[model samples]
Target chain A: MKVYAIYILNKAGGLIYQNDINPGLNKLSANDYLVLAGTIHGVHAIASKLKPTEFEPSSKPFGGEKEIPIESSATFSSSISVRDSTINNDVVNGRWNNPNTNNTGLRSIETDLFNVYVFQSLTGIKFILITSPNPIVHNVASLNLKINKGELNRQFDLAKEIFHNIYVTYSDYVMKDPFYSLEMPIKNNLFDSKIRELAK
Target chain B: MIYSFSIFDRHCNCIYNRRYIHDGPLLTQSKPSSVNLKNSIGDPLGVSITSLPPDNGSGDNFSPLGITTKSKESGSSSAINGPIPGYINKYNDSNASKLLFGIMYSLKNITAKLGDLASLFNTLKSFSTENFRVHFMESATGLKFVLATDNEVDNLQHILKELYTNYYLNHVVYNALSPVEFGTDANEHGKISNSDFINATDSFLTSLSVFK
Candidate 1:
């Protein structure tokens, strides 16, 4: 769970802030980093688009049809009505649950080398956390060596807490600063020190 | 339940890709020559049928027969080249690999921003979700290996290193048909088409307990 780097991208996909907490990466030009941020933002959009769409049946009422036996028609109409209502209810519930579908464009991408966690604010600002691979400590270990599920949850909980604190610090030191401009590079000393503290 | 294994050169060009299917018998889309090689190395008779074992279930001894049987069944031979049903192309579509490369590229640079004695920058190693785990390893020359497994896997760095040393370096880098390219996706000519590499990698991946 080592966080190697962190990046912040504006809603427009511009690189607003970048920090490297650990060493071991090669250097890239300033322009290249912006390009990388934009590319990730674009890919995240595409990934959101690529998410599988849930199937939903149309809820339109059945049109007029030839009369059949009362019993058969009653059963057929009742089944259709039931299906329609269920579909309608699902649509209603889905919309209520996820009003902003694109609020978080790219959630995470897991690779053999590292895990990237993306935290997108309600305002569309994105925070990307690049962390070392999560340990599979018990993959081949003895049964006694397995870490409890609660411990794993606690590790992730810590990560979430760190990200939240970073967001809070950003809002205070970077966002509210009178001199700071939107989508500009963050160079505030307070923000930097606070980030360093969080990383530590 | 391992999904696939892919090897990328420093430029993020996918050099070798093998998708593993578990819903049915382990089937792959590898060519015929690779299949023959696997048959020779894995299971000559194809009599072994491997079952899905419990994840992290310890105390059960890892049987040599079980390992060989799995290798034979999952071998990417020429005969079983059928349309894979659960097969997933997670990266190629939507240029996800390009984005992946860009993220790592910038990360390395930022990490190196501060002066360090080692002259090294740490990059992302691996990430997992509830469903799958991806293990990543990079060689000294920038070649990166990615393995996406559905179950937990251990010692993946060693596996990646072995694959790089035993297969990629020997077969692709040293092969006459392929020439290494920089900063560009490895086109078909640059891809690892060697049958021996594919066979060796298939056997190695299948031997992992996570490949069930």
Candidate 2:
């Protein structure tokens, strides 16, 4: 079965993730996905900035406490680009001091003849997966099945399974990460290795 | 009620100590005879409640110093603590209610999102995907759940707070294991043996206890 593309968008609709799985599907210009991610990123940033503060005048005596923390500039900025490939290789090679710390970027995408699956998280991370129209993705790992048509259902399931697997890996390596910036592109090579393992 | 040491009262066999205080020419007792015992580790010993019990006046049963005692013998060592025998107990007995409640509360939260938590801390917590999944096996009368991450204490604190406050008696206990060994580990009943589960239970309980 043929799987096509993967795209990850931050909660802001910015295209933080875009990758073709099959490599045969129509390819968007490299800059197009980046522009999409940037636009969404800008919109999300503005939305957060524009969020109205809830300040209700209370008749009750104040507890002598206020809610807002002084908004100083963030310590980490988007300009800081750490290569995922370097980090992952360093970790696998045992060169990095911290094993648990690293970026696990966006979810995987799968494509087949029919539809695509996009998995989302509560934190507004979007994982887009495209897969074959068959049901065989359900049992993607089953080998040497003599019947091809009978396995179609299994193919679809397998694709779903792959997405689920990818989702799990994403949450484990990426979402749970405290250091990872929100709405930023993920670049960890460990994720790449896991995906390749999943594909195999 | 200074339970400075000696906490495990699982059998409620805590021995009480009674001492005397000087009441100006007359002899009065010191603190109440309350025993401190611990079953759940990390829970705070309930407040030092050597409080005197209230007197039952025409049945009003209220006192300003604290709750009144019902003991007819006012000088009795055990009777000094309270109106009823509920002396130093956080509520009635030890505050196992709060500690176990916290654990159970956390368990509810941890179990509710078992699969979700599997990926985050599985490696540090020493569990795999298949082993973390919790599906009820009615026949074996057991359950399974994902292990929490030991990589960070903040996350464990979050889980513990939820459990201690929302604890309840649950017959089902969960264990974490590797995916490949999930079913094979369950010989016939689809659940880990009681002894195996005990080890896992001790692991979790000990973690929470120390964490507390």
**Best by TM-score, which number?**
1
Give stretches of model 1 more than 4 Å off: A1-7, A15-116, A129-155, A166-200, B9-13, B24-117, B121-124, B127-134, B140-142, B150-155, B169-191
Which docking band does candidate 1 fall into?
Answer: incorrect
| lDDT of model 2, residue B32 | 17
- Model 1 scores a C-alpha lDDT of 0.51
Best-performing candidate as measured by DockQ = 1
In model 1, how large is the Cα lDDT of residue A128? 78
lDDT of 2 by residue, B99-178 (tens): 22222223233223212222322211111010011111011112122222111121122232222222211212232331
Q: What are the TM-scores, per candidate, against the unseen true structure?
A: 0.50, 0.26
Quick one: best lDDT, which candidate?
Answer: 1
Candidate 2 residue-wise lDDT, A12-107, digit = tens: 676765556555443446675565444333322322221111112223332333222111112122112233445777778765321111011211
Candidate 1 C-alpha lDDT tens digits along B52-147 = 232312112211101111222232232133343222222342233443445445444433442223534334444443334455677778777877
